[model samples]
Target: MLTNKSSSSSARLTFWLGLVGLPIGIVAGFLAGASPLLLCLALIVGAALLWFFTSFEQAVIGLLILRSSLDLFSGLQLPSAFAIGINALTILYVVVALLTGKAVHTDKFWWFFVGWVMMQSLWVILLPLGGLGMGAAFLPSAIKVWMRYFSWLMIYLLVMQLKDRVPPEKLVSLLLLSLVAPISVALMQIFLPASILPSLLTAQAKAGSNVSGTLGFPNGLGIFLTMFIALIWWKLSTSQKRLPWMILLGLVSFVFVRTGYFTGIGAVFLLILFINSTKITPIRVIGVVLFCSAFVYMFGSTEFGQQRLTEIYQTPLLNPNIDISRAIILSYGDGNSFNWRLAHWNYLIEAWKQFPILGYGLDSSPVLGIKDFRTGSGFAPHNDYLRFLVEQGIVGLLGFVLFLTVQGVHLVNLLRSSPPKSDRRNLCLLLLALFVANLASMLSSNIVDATTFFLYWWTLVAIAGWGNEYWQTHRLTQSA
Candidate 1:
């Protein structure tokens, strides 16, 4: 009887799997105009072909190069199989991080990061307890977004653990070259005709000059341009090929300006402030201030620049002091981007009251109807602060804020301690500028959800934060 029961259970499992797969097989056959068996064979063959060229390490590197260049996570008009591949790859990454124990570092950043992680993890339990009622329908998207956050955390851990394994000079050189493909492609997309490249390389078919570069948005492209430019300058500080790199910098800056986004203004300003690698003296600061003031005055004298400044405001006149808080609150109703933002923010603010402690789960913002319904297609909340407050609630937001605070304090300390005109100081200034720019950009963009952004951001965090110590340790070990 026991043998019979085992056989019956195994048969039932096979039957259920077949029942589930039958529809999928039929759909594949109908869509491809081929037999089900042929479609199945093709899938297996394709997977085999892909597998031959793929490995865990290779996938991660490709993620750096390709993901930095493309917006794979956007889920826009792509194949369903791509999503499956991403999910599988993320699972593999998480497994590796866990098995290596790299995710459990005892650093202060780890404590804050893990606290935020734990809060996100608790969403499954929290979202259903008279809260947003975390539905099964949203699980796939939720998991994907959660995976993105986890991927960032994992990369930070890996960098922290392995910063000593590679030299900065070699890595920077490799990246400077590897990044050329994306930058070149972006240039073509913007300056050349879209017909010049295949559809995979150019999304400008429907929309002329989709300045998204490979990342899928103009601002994203702008962010990328500024980032790589900064990296070039970092390399230039120590590089022998100063003239050629300087020319490249000029060309890239020209492209960045055409992007027409001020997202990197703060970062660019900071970079200009310390471009000489001189000590941070008050005189140096005042000179930069005066120089910027003169430039602004000259620029404002131009007709186009005056018009641009006028367009930035144009919010209807309001009471000067109806109590500062009330005046700010009333400003949200103005007819502009601010109005759209306030609409979603107010909606989110109200929704958070449902579960004040833990608002909703990761990726829950989309389902909350927070997107702009202006053109019938939804829009994302450009602000990261609102994203954290609504999705992670107070605890998650607090943890995130604390992590940022730690980052700020650490960078300030590094700046003060590192020798002026040294590699360490230059790196610190570069990292500090990016940090400030990134924070400012967060006020109106989703810089966090970006893939290459995190890779670039975390690498600096590791290097500027603790990579030097690791480098010193490596040197000592080698010398000994």
Candidate 2:
């Protein structure tokens, strides 16, 4: 009787505490205003509390959701919220883990990865003392640029630490869940009234009927949806409930096609080829042929698709009737976005000739006033490879290449060694497909600039590495 009374008293006390604290917290938030620093502080505190109470897997899922859906909160004018919240949570999690003696042990692969990242950071830090001095005015921009690149390193470390804590299946589920909001918002944009939708979530007029979805640009949306198609395709292959996944795949693919981004389409086609490389059976070949035929028929029939194809083959400069000057002017105008990219690539090559070793430093293109043909103004090179070549130079470029090569090798090994029907093997195949898709997308689009896609890419890379190590160790233990 006494125990029951005590339990009831405790429950009442907890209920009262929640009732009082909820309003107090709301009032405090309002009183604090929406200053970036204050908002960051509140987010950090809330995230820290969440990290402490929840499993690391849950925290990771929440972080990914925030990273992906940040554009939804742009109306609040808190552009830095996503970066600040992510970095704070990551730092806090690392600090807590270290203090509690739960720090993840590293292997040689991690050491090499960290060393390469540090080398890039060292070059960026010494930039002011080197070629172009970093001005105080440009310091913040440089830091933000550095942070954008460095966050991938932090993501890798976080995933490595949680490798043992979270199961692979759980991680996959969380990733799919994180994608839900962005995909839903993208779908809603097609049907919702323009006035009801956030401006950033809707397609811009300049995109020429291509939908940008929540990414604010057609190319960004293309990269994201293409990756989703690859992932969902793999899921459908393995899942018992195929209908739902097929529906999602169709929706995302339709939106992606509507974006009119050729790179994404090419990437998906390449992924399909890769998936069927080992199987050349008659039925498989027929299926592949039919799929390609149907896709081509649908795409070629669309007005935007017809226009894009015409632009590719019919350059105004190639016309014999136009004078040289008139041809140049016409080719550089609004109708020739592809020609603009070619011009930007040419400019980047010339810039690379100046500082071929350790280029102008991170984020130096805007600072140094690199000419962008796209807008006849200054902007970073649209090509990621070109950006690296101009910003970090040959050493940085090589290091990045090595990082990618190592990941590819690891994934291939994992796929070859794992059982064909195992979950891990399917995941490896999916990651490889996504990697190839993004690589193709990066040729013309700045793949890294899309925060959600970039984060998703690196997270998959880290998870693949962690899983490879886990399975290898398990095999060894079994043999012993």
Candidate 3:
């Protein structure tokens, strides 16, 4: 009884409605289930529905996964069985995608493969007995290796597909929100009689004794907020971006100061360099004076600021007392920890002689072994490059160097070709901030262990691709 046009309209409406309904239903069903296995299945179903029905679903999922990853160090509170089940679900999703021929392709496959090879290379290089002793001694090494990179690959694939769908503004918004959400929640928790705030502080402080900030020892969160502020400050000052972000940054800074995390002070200075770099005359001088005065006032406070101030400049290594008032310095005028880094680097450098090709399997540090290193609570080397050298040997390190070098060169070229006043300029600034932040994190903390490392690398690359596309489109439009 209906015409063809009416029939088509009905089908389209039904399809659109289903698209919205299915994802909600799938996610709800998954969360509603008490059984871990059933929940995992529901997550997979939700993943599939989201992937198929939404345009920016990949980016959304990627961000969700990354946001969830802060839990990597924070206890999941899930049973071991449940964790394994989730891993299985992830694997199943990948396999299903491949079988269904929805497999995303990328020219960057080699770079991804190199990442895997680097992990495998660890097996042969670091272990003294050529990794044979590792399996018998540490069966869990295999699982740990998978845990580090599997989700990363899936996220990369998802990003590759959804790169264009995630606008630059939205990307910026997500980061701002990540910082704001935690700060807001933590602030409220401070007033409320909640068990979470105390527990969180205790755990995070133990992980790194130097942490001090409003959200309990704010090592991770502080660094994260600082980075976001830098990015947002640049965007807001340079472009007509949203005003809420400026307000958000102010709130975050207040929390950082209130927490007494001295590291955030350094991070704020680093951010200021980019934001106020152009102001060269009276304002710059005034800013510097104000900064120094504020720093002194904050440092002078005993009850709130003393603990953080002491941790800020306290150097490890060479100092007999762990709580030295000032950073220890060697006779050579280097920070004592600076000397230790050189010493450890030298040790790894010498060890590379034995296995120049494949060094050692994943856990090269003492924390992974039976005994802790002299450095205290030993784990992997704090330096990402050194860790790679120790674990994967020269071969894997070489591949990584090449990959990063090419990416760097590409970024430089892109920046040079684009106009300074263009929107694409923000990408360049973001890249610069990330490059500096990651470099600093590598020098100070174990970058790879922090959830920051994986997210930073993937997000930078995705944004780079996004910028490249925009540049190309702009050129085409001008030509037309």
Candidate 4:
């Protein structure tokens, strides 16, 4: 006598219960001296249950949380953990999307980008097979490097599926909330003695060195915060609750400066200038002028800041008397970070000459036997563009450039097509700012190597996509 709807609900409940209980039963049986095969079966069943039961939203949030929590285990240096977690969650999300019949939405340009990436990956893989094959010792690392690069595509696909389910604003809010942990860790690092801090939350730093926060490197933390400063400032500008947002912005900026990353500081200044140029108003102009004045004053007041500013404007490279190549080699011995980078760049440029088309394959820089003047060993060039040039070659670099260009064009279109003062336009502008800031940071830091930074970068891309789709849908609905 039960209704059809009630019977269907009961069936669904029973099915889920069985799915959950089966894994537990398998685990219990294994604990009770069951065959080793039972343990393997349990693992498979558990993985399948996790994949099937986890919603897309949950997977997205879980990925973000897992990335944020990585700094807590910095001592382990477990990048493999990040690679595995991200890949697993992404695959699971895709499987769920397919099962739910959700369309994998993407534009023609995006498809082309994906196809190009695949081709580059294939070339890198086959390059070794075609020539002096990849060393057995280097094979696993090479595969990992490719996986890390490919993960960005997976992230984009997963977020695309959730474009309608998750709003861009909510994603940004989550990111803002995630900042709390790192900021708090930074604050503790500043206040507490190094010996007193938990090893997991602190890293090796020079005596009296600036706080690095959860990222473990002071410059890295500065670069990370710099990427978000413009976006936060944008939010501050649009927000009604000015006092709280202003306070938060001040706190983040204070942490940013304390990291003592001169490049990051310069990048922030450039971003401010860019924002001001985009929309010049009387009030905005005044505010920008005041900000610039304060910025100059703050740096001028401190000897360290003044020295950094001087280095930025007048490095030894500009001197005609200094032989650039000799100076670069000497810089490694002189302990000058800037000069060391120049030397690395020089080496990488020379190395690129050997494999100009496809390069020496992904992650080949460390093992390609190029001499590192600093440590008497091979090392990755700190500059990302050089890394791409040496590792992936010209073809890889062009593919990357094209991808960025297409993304930039799409963002610009979204910015222009959206109504003035609309959420979509605002979000697009913020994403653009974040993208430019990260790109600027790449000159000095291989920002993409860090999993957290990777997450932040691609999440911005996803949010931009979300904004575009949301706006288009709203326009169509209104017209209809």
Highest TM-score against the true fold, candidate: 4
Per-residue lDDT of candidate 1, residues 1-480 (tens digit) = 977866765676566557857886776768578566777776886575356234543443444455564463355633233434554555554454454332423356655666666656666555545454345555666666666666566666544543444555454455565456656766777667676766665553223533555666656666777677778777655665577876776666655544444445555666666564354566656755764565455435544345445534542334333433443365456434443455566667787777666666767775564544465544556778877777778877887788788878878887776655556666777878777777878887777766566766765666555544543222111100
User: What lDDT, from 0 to 1, does candidate 1 have?
Assistant: 0.59
User: Could you give candidate 3's per-residue lDDT for residues 124-155 as a string of tens digits?
Assistant: 44444544324335436644654555555544
Q: What is the TM-score of each candidate against the true structure?
A: 0.68, 0.79, 0.65, 0.82
Residue pairs in clash, model 1: 382-445
Clashing pairs in 3: 122-360, 122-361, 123-361, 125-358, 125-359, 125-360, 126-359, 126-360, 213-259, 214-259
Q: How far in Å is the alpha carbon of 413 misplaced in model 3?
A: 2.9
Q: Which 10-residue window of candidate 3 scores lowest in summed lDDT?
A: 471-480
Q: How much lDDT does candidate 4 score?
A: 0.67
Model 1 CA lDDT for position 103: 45
Q: How do the residues 1-480 of candidate 2 rate in per-residue lDDT, one tens digit apiece?
A: 977866765676566558868986886688478576776777777667766546667767677766666655556745366666566667776665554444464545567767776776765566656553343455556677777766766776667776777776667657776566666776676567667876666636343466666666677777777767777766776667778987877777777777777766778888877766654677767756776666666667767877777765544446456443443355566566566566556667777788888877777665343354567667657778777777778877887788778767767886786665566676688778777766776777777677667777767767766654453222111100
From the highest TM-score down, the ranking of the candidates is: 4, 2, 1, 3
Give the whole-model CA lDDT for all candidates, comma-separated. 0.59, 0.67, 0.52, 0.67
Lowest-sum lDDT 10-residue window in model 1:
471-480
